[model samples]
Target chain A: MVSKRMRVAANVKRGPYATLTLQGEVIPSHPGQFYMLRGEWGISPLLGRPISILGEDLARSEIRFLVKAVGEGSRLLHALKPGETVQATGPLGNHFPLSGWDPQSPVVLVGGGVGVPPMAYLARRLSENGAGVIFCQGARTKEDLLLLDEIQETGVTPHIATDDGSAGEKGLVTGLLERELEYQPGAVFACGPEAMLRAVARLCRGKVPCYVSLEAAMGCGYGVCLSCVTRVKEAGKVVNQRVCKEGPVFEAEALPWL
Target chain B: MAVNLAVKVGTLLLKNPVMLASGCCGYALEMGEFFDLSLLGGYCLKGLCAGGSEGNPPPRLCETPGGLINSIGLQNIGIEEFLREKAPKLRRVNSVMVANFYGHSVEEYAAAAEKLQAEPCIAALEMNISCPNVKTGGIAFGTDPKLVHEVTAACRKATRKPLWVKLTPNVTDITETARAAEAGGADALSCINTYPAMAIDVEKRAFKINTRSGGLSGPAIKPLAVRAVHLVSKAVKIPVVGIGGISTWADAVEFMLAGAAAVQVGTALFSNPNAPLEILKGMEEYCIRHGFKDVADLVGAARDFERPDCNLPSAVIVTGEKVRK
Candidate 1:
């Protein structure tokens, strides 16, 4: 619920993407949660862009975001110089489920492009909790495979894929996921493009429990605006749930993916 | 010098003139996590209808330059659920709570109002006749003067609570509806709901919002809203509560001068959750600077101006005359 101006500690660019490190009195947050980040002042781009909580260090009060320079809002975030501040309002939406998870069975995490950041943090937490973790990431090219070193630091080697045959597996990351599902992983956690998520949901439908983090164009990142609603089936009836409020995370079985 | 921020919308007395608009403020309780709800003069909770509504589909919002078009379609958990889950929590917050309700038909509107009238936490009721997102009920009930009067009268008979009719900007003359509502016994009027607007993604070659068109709100519509508030205020004896792209205290003051007794902050809360309080502080400072004893004194403060005749040179009329029928 905290929204304040945090100084840009660093901006590490990887081609069209950038991992922004911000330092301040960070809001307490978990993996898969996000902040609505924006410039200190502007009305042209009205709403704050919702950026996932890629990483955090509560002791140092530092937070990180994986931003893609795709539009006006993210471009503004990527172009920020160190020492400049951006308004960060966050710890919003539900986080990845961690409790009651068995450490004996392996946990598989799927991330694509900018979606890799949250999974990296999730992998670290699961590994720390004595769980065997497998991280899979996909990108357009070898250069787009983000946070290889970071994911490795969590003591898990990310199974990588590139669309152009420029990386580990020369195909979609879902191919890697399909291969791993054979081993009967305990759970599948994912965050990525809708098409990728749909594939993950389909692959894990009856085999293992699956969870996904969703994104939408939001007005107010709170419940009020109702801008970020997505359809989810509950009690045999389909209903709209706000991605910012009801969840950015939901069980795969509930989503009616086409 | 002490300044009184309190203002009256008919019989309903708000601590200040700044309240969050309906639809923009949710149920008025979700924001308690960010700040104290009591800081606002009042907040009109999201529009509720009979049996509740599921709202519109995803891709519900599209951002335009300095504005946003939303087609939330009046989603709610139903009045029974609100009373069961949210109302108990709402009772704890010390602020004016305005329950905004709508219906697919006039009887539905009355039933929803009557259902909400028993809640002690609700200080007033804002009947939404102007939501542009829905297909049948909302804006359809707002565009015509006869329908506006009919619906207002139905709701007026349903509840003794201070009734405010939220007018739609989609109408040709906003004043016509304003007069009709007043004649039908509306205690107050909320001038100008979001303008019916649309946007398209040129790359995708598709409508940005699933509803195709949505209600546009934000700073882009503020001027048009201010003009509507002025016209509506003059047309009706009831107080006008201005709503549109009011983001700052100066904007609120502008509305007051244009004839609104109170103002609502809607889209600005998306960008800055603290906008209402900041606008409240700014309004207080503005009053202090102007040596006004009360915020109510600022209402309708703008003086009438003489129309200046335009005397353009003959050379400027060349294309105008040439294109004549």
Candidate 2:
């Protein structure tokens, strides 16, 4: 819950994507938990951008984020250099649960574009815990694929899909999930574009338990400003849940998908 | 030298002039994770009604240059849930709690006020008349002076707690509603709600928010808010609570100098959850630097400078001592 200035350790850029590392008294974060990061100090862009935890090294006191220069707030973050300061407020929101998992079944992890960071972090945690892991990622092209070396460093080679057939497969990540579902994966966890997650949720509907991390344009990432709410069906009633508070992650079945 | 940061809005005394605007800080519980709630002068809870609302659809916010547009549609957990769930936790927070509520009609407003009246944790009631009137085919209650007076009087009769009417800035003359609220037995007036505004995404060829238009708040609206406070404070005899894009201590001081008895920080809390306490500290430093023994003395201080024959006070003397007293 601490909000303070943390010095940037490095901004590793790969095309338009960046893996930003910050060194400071970092807040310990769980997989799927995020930090509200604002590059520099000003009111031009009023609120902090919610960035998911790409990696955390408590030993080094460093936190990492995978950022895409899509918007003003993120462009500010992507432009940071080593020794620059960032206003960080976190380990905010609920994290992906690692309990009650069956050790024998393969844990299928799926990600798309900037949404891959949390899945990468989750993959590392699950593998370290001695759980069977399978990773699937999709992007528009080979160059658009983010954090490939980082995911490979986790000792799990990703089953990649590119839109233009420049990588592993030439289809959406859901196509890979459809193939993996035959192996009876214990659980499906995904973070990606809405269309891909929706397809993943559909593919694993009755066969396997599925969890999807959500995203929205947020004002305050701390539950006050109700800017990032998505509809969830609870107790047979549809209600809005704040992505920053109730979750950036939810059981896919809880969501009201059309 | 010591400085007194306390100020009174009607009979409701705040330890300082720093309060979190309604619908901005939620119940102040989330903010407590970053800082202690007792550090604030007071906070207006999110707007509530009887049955609660689902609010608008997805994409409720849009960011402009130095400002934010939100169409949250007053999503709240309703009075029953607030009283049963939030109120008990808030009772332990030690800072003043103001219940902000709204309704579509006069009777609904009165009923909502009465519902919150029995809660011992709530010190004051702020009536949000910016809601559309269902009886009048969606015309806003605060937009019309008559409706403002009617609704304020109805709510005033419903509760004996200190009543503060939050005036909307969509009206042609904000002071008209301010005076109406005062005449209708409002103890104080919260001047200037968010200005009606909109934003569109060119790429998507769609509106930024689900609701095509929303209310704008942030530094962009500060100057407009200051002018509203200045006019409304002069037009009404009761205390005026300034709110609109106040992000810093200097902004709060500017509101006070323009004749606001107290000021509320809205969108600023989104950027910095520690803003209220920070602004409070900066205000204390400002009082010490300006040689004013009391922060309340700064209210309407700028207005005194406009007088022709008045004897100007020295730097050591506190100006506008008689403005509020």
Candidate 3:
């Protein structure tokens, strides 16, 4: 089938990147999946890059993304004006299984830099599910804090951190998470740089249930190119798992730390 | 009436010859939504090894004029996990799935094959003789015909499924290696794997891809791969599947005419997830248009007294000395 081609409803500059909210109707109950977007659409490059779903309003029929301009594709995506049409194939990949959480458990949402996008979607769902969600967001500077108000609407108490001490508490998001461990909730959900994930994995080691969304330059946003594989050690054996297939979100213990 | 683009190699058959090549197609089951993967003839998953391994560090890819160089280092989910997690999905696909296996030692190839041969989804197994030989101590299995025969024979003995030995073109007289593999009891052949290649960045004064070297593929290697298929087809009775730089249906047709039973799609998928389907359709239409009932009849029919027109150099070319030594 031809992939769903949509238009950019709005574009907002956040920190060092830009977030384009595409006009596509994905229900809030979607459990969150990614969209494969093309910057310069058509036959130029056959593969469409995968972008995470940040938040969507079912009534409004709009999906949001928090993206940083890091490469040629992102640069072109960021340069587009609002209402410009770009091709998007989504809500692709598997959705997070939120069955493990309970009402009494402390659900921690840890996000570092741009890895923070999907956490917004997860946090919204956890709040709706009565998981007592604690949203921890981290970025390099003050300008990187995104969707603070949107997060608050979900009844999540937002904790912030910056690399240069420009926001809530200086240091890493894991540092802020260390302080919030006092909540002693049920589980943790995080998305961010690989190094920060390793740090969070170490901090939550055997302490609580943790899940992290992984990022890789995907050729086919679905799971064709085994390029997005991440290693996980299970039962004393290591296995390479596709970040897009088995998960864009995997249990912290289940992750094969690269 | 619909044209039949599926390719049949011995008892094994493909819905279409445009298959997703290993390292290009992760695990067959999880890739369906992106491209309706069921449409392809078959899928060759990322090379699985006996022991779990972490591939080379990133910046694993760099683009060329009409192709790419990748040093993915055979990243796989290992045999056990694949069986438990990816097998069910693979079995569900209408197309074929050929598990691509590589090992540092002959024993590992046998063991990895043993693990996959049990799964009904696996229609065949393709052995990458190009993988570094950690045993006999540290040489690539593909570069030597002796090791090629040994690995292929060991794998063939371990499984009843069709055995395909994927020969690398980084050798002198590829036909000699094809003969060795046939002697080793391979059911068929896929010639050739991407030739060993590299790239350099003029500004940084350094290599573009990680590992400082990688496998070059896409349109650039099509001519060479076609030649390899044509030569190997004449030299051996076992079927040959052509792979390299095939981006369109015309390329697939060219390989078939040159004596390839089927074709594999790798770097091309990096650009279009649905390209395999398009190529498959195009092939079927081409056959019908030419008054042919099945394209299999076209294999190797293009042979003439004069050589085929190919853009690749008549001889293999190398950039510099090996540093990994």
TM agreement with the true structure for every prediction: 0.94, 0.94, 0.75
lDDT of 1 by residue, B43-103 (tens): 9998887688888777888889989888888888888888888999989787889998998
| Root-mean-square deviation of Cα positions for candidate 1 versus the true structure, in angstroms | 4.3
Model 3, residue B135: displacement in angstroms? 7.4
Q: Model 2 Cα displacement at B238 (Å)?
A: 0.7
Model 2 lDDT tens row, B113-157 = 999999998999999976421223123888888888888899999
Q: Is candidate 2 or candidate 3 better by DockQ?
A: 2
Tell me the docking grade of candidate 2. Answer: medium
* Most accurate candidate by lDDT: 1
Q: Looking at the true structure's interface, with contacts defined as alpha carbon pairs within 8 Å between chains A and B, what fraction does model 2 recover? A: 0.75
Clashes of 3: 11
Q: Tell me the lDDT of model 1 at A79.
A: 85
Higher DockQ: candidate 1 or 2? 2
For candidate 3 chain B, the 10 contiguous residues with the lowest summed lDDT are B316-325
Alpha-carbon shift of residue B53 in model 3 (angstroms): 6.3
- In the range A1-258, model 2's lDDT, one tens digit per residue, is 777788999998876778899989977888999999987658888889999999899999999999989888888899999999988888889988775667788889999987899999998998788888899999999888877787888898899999999998998888898999999988999999999898999999999999999988889898999989988888899899999999999999999862
lDDT of each: 0.88, 0.87, 0.75
Better of 1 and 3 by TM-score: 1
Query: Candidate 1: lDDT of B92?
Result: 76
